[model samples]
Target: EDRLLPLSVEISEIEALGGPLLLHSWREGIDDVDNDGEADEWEYSIMREITPMKENGTVKIDFPSLELVANGEFGKVSLYITGTDLAGHPVLNGGAPGVDNDMATLVTQDDLPTTISQPSISLDRWGNNLLVGQIHEFSFSLTDDNGIGSIDNISIALAPGDSRGDIWLDPLSRELSVNDNSPIHPVGLVIDELAAGSYKVKIQFRLGVDSPQSWNTSTQKPSVIVTEHGQVLELGSNSLSHLEWTVDGRVNLMLLSADDLSPPHSELFGNTLYLQPDDRFNFSGQLHHPANGLNVILDGDWQVNFSMDDNQNNAENWYTILSDSSSFMATSEIPQSRWNHGSATVQATIVGGVQTIPITDMKLHIVIDSTPPQLDFPVTTLSTINSNQMMQQLVTIRVNEAGGMGQNPLELHWSFRRHGVEISNMHGAAQLPLATDAEGLWTYSTRIDFDVNSDLLLPGDDLVIWVVGADLAGHPLEGIGTEGNSKMTQLRVIYFQPVLSELTVSPYQPTIESVFTIDGRVLNEGNDMGVVKVGLWAWQSSGNGGRYHILNETNLTLLPQQHAFFTFSQEAWDSGDLQLYIAINDDDTNLTSVPVGLVREQTTGEILWQNIDSPAAVGLMILLISVVLMVVTAAIRRSDEEWDDMDEEEIPPPPPWAPDEWPEGAGPPPEILTQSTSLLEEE
Candidate 1:
């Protein structure tokens, strides 16, 4: 059975003793799958991952099971325990000799790493002829089944020019050899120390193997094409932070490599930046500068500036920023007052020690606004108008500015909604560009009409009409009132009927042969129907002065609240009395034919108005006329008898009804005969 053991060795012999680590104590990446502080029994599993690098010295990794990643470019690599973390440096089975190198575990645990089934080596750059005194860089990648685990020693094994050195090699690059007692050179360089002749180099390195103190001395002759001149590196195009970088020009910029480090850290690719009000802007990027014939880093102080085309006076504004140190970081902020309340195109230009580049495609926008319009509706005058008679009443509207931005003439709109429903149904729409009168109010002479055939309006329907106003900036009236804008009072169309009243006639007292005029008014108390016809007539004495006759008749038309006048001139053919009457046809709506009468005598003073729709007065007037005719006949006989001297003898006996048979002392032989001597009645 295996048991734990304690061991110790000088730090200088650590490299040699770690060759058989699987047989001795530890072999790098051995771990405890279960957490217990002490190493757990575990077997090594081979993994290969192409870890990405930033601009620092180390790379961060999420998991060690990178068994699926293909070989990609990277820098220095180390080993890690599956469940073990490098914390307070607890000695694992006995601590690794190098405190700073605890991540390089080889002489601690007893788990053996998997052997390299296939070996491969790759070179990213080379030149057959190189500048004599120049420091040339070569990126050589080595691989085995378990990967180059925490490289312990790297040496050169040349057959001809060996260590004791018959030929010289650049000590700068040769320093990558494990022969040096210092740290390893990550970006190994080869200084030309040999003569201008061909030479062979076989590089061998030792790292963690399957057993403790057991090592694999893998060897490879990396192709070295050192050039005196003429060598080009093709790094096509790349993009970062919304800016596209084209490295095809004579002065192209490339992103070399990056690693994990602390603040002042740099990135080969720029960082994403988001800008907003009251927030500082922070951004960064690192790029490789180009030389005439060398693929190398150009490091120096850089000037970064930002410009916004949409800002006010933008042509004179430029913001200077900083990107200092090897890990360059260009950072700046946008002032709150600098916002233009509009979209703009932004650009950031980085002036490196050797070149200048303008990054395009940055867009931003800003805005600050809030408020509504003020409105007031005043009282109108014209009222008591008939329904459907055009609500043509005077209306007053007043408005103020919107959002404190002065009057909104160009952006204003108006609408008239009824009962809080469809405006179109009410024959209305949102008329844009504000329709206002000279006083800035909407003086709309509103009229309501309904076609009983197709319109939706109904009589006596309570219709609420509203006039709404708004601005293009989305400012509607405040509270808009409960009913909104303007409302209509109760209005309804109704039936019309003519009612006549207030009759007047000129010349209340008239003389014979004089003229008189009669006047009356007709009112449409209901909905208007049409004109009304009023006829005028009168009763007067006949030419014989014995009976009354209807004469002087005429007609007139009157509208609602209109006056009908009748003018007539009469000559007194003989002394008599007259009666005048007026009437309207009773067949039409609200029409009546009650005759109005007036009585006047040619010799009397006053005129009398009497309603005469009876036959009693007609019978009395006929009796009086008969008495006058009898008297006239008696007189005519007397005149004839006197003229011819034989009338009374020849004449027949008087009728008993005649006054002639009365006693001589009778009252003046009947008053009618005395009154009717020779005069006739006039009307």
Candidate 2:
């Protein structure tokens, strides 16, 4: 049976027919009819012959293999010949063996050459250095005689160790087709997001049904280095520098002020800064990459007078008021009127550029106080005390400083003087430390003790007291005094003839029935002879009223600065409560001593009697008495019931009582006999 071959068939299927399938051209006209080793006109024979292991007797056509070549451009690649024909001669310009001229043409997938050029890659921005957070385009190009349609697909991937491993190019792989008749084809991939790092981009292309091959540029693999935008370069004390691109070099600007300086001299309280009038306000910082080589300009309310220094001599040091080249520093005293406005702002800019760029800005609420601390003396200016006795007075002064409290230490200066001369032996011009009560307040309270006695102060002498203070900014105290001539008060020393100085009372918690002793000492605290009557007195309060009665009296005579002791005792007779004290009285003065003893009525008894006032104890005692009475009543009732229950026969005869056992009148009463006679009658 004869079979016809299909339009398309696999080589293996053709071989299953038991032999090679061959085709020959046939014509009615006779010309080289047998296709035997001859060349003739009008010939009908096989177009080409295949010979196994030997050269054939017919002409053969051999296709040239292709390889990739750099076109010395960014994104273009060229295809050239690499394989030769059977004669060991190179096939020039993608032509067959018979063709003499070079030409480019498109071919089908089945007619494609063995090898083709890979794609060349290029980036649209910054060559290989890319910035993060920006969109970039990568172009892939190829030049092949097989035309653009020969390419099946294009793929892009990132190398290992890349941070964006999960990211894949959109469409994963591109299926490219011919849009035009051009031999050179270009494809693009847009990457809109990428992480900040160095990455190697890999590109691949497949011609027709061939395996994918790697693609790269001429010098290196397609790569990119991504960096962060607007990166901070350096940080200094109270300043910062940022990197930014400009028409000039990269610009780095930093600003500084007294508010942000180290070892700060200004104080801030509730959004307002406090400063002294004499303090210097410093404004300084550095400026880098200035446009047109112009000096930095101040644009706001702050009129800074900047002075530049030669930076060549001090290149290793940071820019300050003393040295720098690209920096500015101004030291000026701020006016008090300007600082009183409650707030201020400073702004700087580089003005010589095409467009003004802001360098730095700072705003602060400032308060410059020229007035010193205010002092208000709350106690009397003059005080009087005896020569022998010591008197202490609390000198409280209310200080209202401009800034607040607890900023600095306040000093109290005191001195002793006789007439107009200061006594060097005594406490002269000494400082007393002060402590504040709280923080962040306008006023503070401090107290000092002023002692007046003969040891440091003589009769008719004076003790001078004053206060001095300063704020953190070195502002001195006001209203009270200056450091050299301070305002002060004097304490007067006088003569007190005799006084009951020390008094004692034995048994502080005394009972009403116990005797208490009152002892005292009379001192002559004057320069003249003194005589006084010392007496012990007791006072008791009653429902009617209260009165003091003299218990004992004694007369004493004391020389100047001499003291004597006196003792007295009194028997406690009155109940309730009483007070015992010693009193010294003279013709013109009467003085009472301290620590008067208080006596209360105390009852002597057992523990229960002592605690009789407690409700729990009283309740327990009543319960016990009720229990005893109930027991006695129950016993009596039981005895009566037994007596009544007994019959006259059960009573029997009373025990025989001998005459000797019955004492004269102590025998059983008549009631017993009457009961026995009644019982006998009943029986």
Candidate 3:
């Protein structure tokens, strides 16, 4: 048999067969169906009485199933209908074993999708607030069709358009490089140690096949919100979200009264504030109250108010100062009874929620010292400083101690007064440094200078300045005006400042024996006229430091801006630098000069320095030359005397008479002739 006979049975009856129905299947080649090595044969089983066929003549059989993990070989599978209740049943065989009818395609989970789009990026924490020095971490969560390749960049900037910040970063991939084979998609941002302020965070992303510009964030949501550590800071992606940070320390502030609108804070007083009439001021600085425990708000805005009493006698006239809530004024309204009179006291109380705190030692006492403040100045010390800096008027003002940094009620209010009123706008109200004394009084001192339009001071017209002793509150020191020791007013005598100009030497670099002229003009740089001396002087830089003489001078009275010229002549001196100088108004006082120098004489001159025109130096040279000439003349006379001695005279007499032997015959005749001539000459 071929083992391929056709078989048919009732579909309903065959499906009821729950037992295993064996098929007579056989293979030609070896197939390890059971996973064991060798090939095996199938056992043939009987036929079954199945249900009858339907209209299409298709029989259905319910065959019990068995699960198998064997790998079937590509061999033939046959079925035969044998003896049974329903005989001649043919069981058909399939073309091949272990083959699926419908083909399947491979699918990968990580591969990029057909259509690419932008990734949705965001932070894990929605809250973005933090402490000033605290470090925190958040994530840049991203989701896309191709997954995240990398984060291109991230940056932080101050909110409200402040670009000066610390959070600028590039390629914030957070180790998400393609080469490392590590799964890096979500980028984490770790913020550490930020200055307390409002800041914003932004970022860009890199996805496969898409540039950062092409990435889409139309569907991104704001998630991160940072808070609790300090101020509330919100963190959002794709858009701007700011972080509000605050420091942990407390803050300081100051508030003045109604009249003084500008807050002096620590500029005037340490812990207390001084107020004048109609003064209105404000307080602006860091403020904080220590937290009692966890979950307590340390930074609380409290309602503060100022109260004052008419007298230190503990009277019942305490009144609240009425002021604008936005102003730095500690009080809303100051009762006239407190500040209008002297010797009044004031304090401030703060109401923070249910807690009330009264700060003490913030005393405001009225001042009433009848005597004006005394001004002391060492005239000699002040005169040496640059008069031009003092506006050509020497003035050293020291307000008598008003309790040093802490001005008590008895302090002096020293100021420049004009037209019977204090000139508060002197150089735009300059702030001077404070000096502390042993008596615990603080004083302020300064120099006044009005550079322009100083022609205001006429002759003998005193520049009036006032020094009044008063408390911070409006009371002035009262005293009888004394003639010489008047405490309240000081009159400075303005002297005309003589400024020497046009200072020059005719021959700038003078040669030896050459005459040079020193010319200068004196101009009164000050307001009034005074007697000023203009002089020409020279410094011989020959090992002399201060030894210089004024060769010429002229005393003259110069009015303001009026000038006069004085000139002098002198012969050039010294080969080295000759300091030729001219000055005005420097007689018997600190000298100032415009000096010119002459190069030292080298070739035309000798080694020593000399006013080449000076007769003493020339005479010394002539005397030495004369002495050398006299010595040479004496030597010549001695030589002449020696030459005369060497000459031979007609030494005839001795020789003719004494010679007897060699020229015996001629000797007698020569001797007779010599004796005859000698006798004749003698006679």
Candidate 4:
């Protein structure tokens, strides 16, 4: 019977191994599928199977081989074990199943890793033709199949004569090779080197591998292209394979690489720039110096400076690439002259760089305004005595333009003064009823009334109407400063009614010393009655007979339909034949006075005078007065009664009524019967 035996190898032989064996050992990887600390039994199976020679009848086995992976990477490897039984039949206890079943019988436990896989490479540059000073970086990663080893001991070499080969690799990238010395694993690498020649870089490297007995090796090759200094690598219009540039004249400015380019953290290699004839200037505010307030202006050449936190600090700095300030024409005009107002960019380059960058599209804005409205109106007086009263005038304000005009409602500042003396300030809107209309060609007006007793307003009184318009934007338009302010208009409220005529006093020719009463009447003969104000004073004329004067004016309510009365005492009259003068104002334009015949009243009862008259004349006057009285009486009586008083029979009363005269079979009429009989019995 066969029994299992403990197996092991001397540690010294492991170190003495060399060449392929050592390389194989180094390449071999460890695996522990179940996470146990100890190596899996299957790991020693391969070594045990590598037994002694058949003639010696000694069993022998070779070490299992694997590869290394980078740090933190998983590695893996697989092996087949075969053997024969004593009867000469192949030993089959855990042999792989038939082709159809193809199941693996060997088992493993623990987390040990197995084989290492080569890393991939990525190359990038900002522009075509990498310059000597410009560093190009190539990136790659190493990986493995199992969890055991690391990428330690991997050596990356650059084939000489290559542009990338002539430069130094980043130290950090070099350190990726020595991460783990245990077994097969992967590593990440970056090469940041550049030279002055176009090159096809071949990245060659050897990585650590592992075996059940010792160590092993694995190698890989990755390649990329690079350019030498001063070489113009022209990326075709559509080809982003190379770096891009913005070139104007001899200067070149590199556009960031299409691959792996981000703005906030993006790096810039050069500062001086130029514009190329073929490329369009496309710039965005983001690329411009930040403090410029994002505004840039391109006058002849470019005169706009970036704004600093303080404008005084940075305003003077200007950017002009090619032509002198006076010679260069602005390529484009945005909504506003300011570039910051618009999205814009420059297709430019650094002198001799011959590179171009596409400036993304940028934006511009424009802004118009108008003056406030003006007001003008006439001044007039409204007279109560005058039949035609003045209506309030409407006020309006006009604007020149819609924009920039304050869009608010109009407010009026109105004042009235007489004889250069200040009066009340009646301030109000032209929009409401108290004033007048607010629209139309700008003008505001309201009626002014004057009392007869009040200080009479004469011509030349200053009447001014003024206003300013405020827009919705709260901007007020001022005509005050410009030729526009007609500002104030002057006018007078005139009394334009005609004078009174035909003035007569009840008692004419009053005594020189007696207190004679006089009643006067005046008629408006002209177009209007400006006013009928009376003044009384005693006076005497030596030759023309004593004249009667006004003593006091009587207060009376004058209605529009008829004349208004004013009574004055004729007392203290010192005159021969009292002559009365009645003054009536037609208007500011006309004033007329009517003369009355004189009457000499010697006694109180004879103030009107008793003249000798014929009986015929008295009778005629009496008849006329009586006839007038009778007609008036009849008219008043006719108006008092609402209905006619005819009898019920004459009027043909309602259906139940009886007639006085019976027709054939009919009963007596209601007047004739007089409640003598009932037609129907009471219920």
Candidate 2: tens digits of C-alpha lDDT, residues 248-317: 2123344544452222354444334456644556555454333333333221222222322222222111
Our tally of clashes for model 3 stands at 55
Best by lDDT: 2
Point out where model 1 deviates above 4 Å.
1-367, 378-398, 402-427, 430-432, 435-463, 469-473, 479-523, 527-557, 561-683
TM-score of each: 0.23, 0.28, 0.26, 0.23
RMSD of 2: 31.4
Cα lDDT of model 1 by residue, 265-346, tens digit = 2122222122333333343333322333443233335554555565455442364433332223433434557642333334
Cα lDDT of model 3 by residue, 1-683, tens digit:
01122323232233322223333222223233464432233322233443332222344544332112222333333333322223334333322222222111111123222211123233222133221111233333323232222222233322223222223343323331222221111223333212222122333211111111111212222332222112233333323332232122211122333233422221334434455433443332222222211111222245445555654545432323222221234432333444433434455453342221212223444332222334454444233322234453433334343422243322222233456454444322223344444463344554545443333433333233333344343334333321223333334435588877667777777776667777777788876668887776666445555667777777988887898877778777656566555655655455555455655454534434555446997897789989998998899989988777764453433543444444655443443444345766888
Write candidate 4's Cα lDDT for 1-683 as tens digits: 11111222221121122211110111113444454433344433234332232222223334533223321222223333344433333433332422222212222223322221122344342232221112234444332222112212222222222222222322322443322322212223333223221112223222111111211011112232221121322212112222222111111122322111111111111321121112222222222212222221111222222211112122212233433211122232222122222122333321211112222222211111123333223323111122123234433334443323222244444444566564554223343112222342332233333222213444455544455454322334455411335244434344332224334544444455445454555444333234455554434466867654454554333333345545555653444434344444312223233233444436645433332245776787799999999999888777654234433435554555335435666554445323334556542
| Arranged by lDDT, best first | 2, 3, 1, 4
Best of the candidates, TM-score? 2
* Model 4 spans with C-alpha error above 4 angstroms: 1-402, 407-498, 513-517, 523-535, 540-550, 565-683
> Where does candidate 1 have its weakest 10-residue lDDT segment?
207-216
Q: What is the lDDT of residue 615 in candidate 1?
A: 72
TM-score of 4: 0.23
Better of 3 and 4 by lDDT: 3
Backbone clash tally (model 2): 0
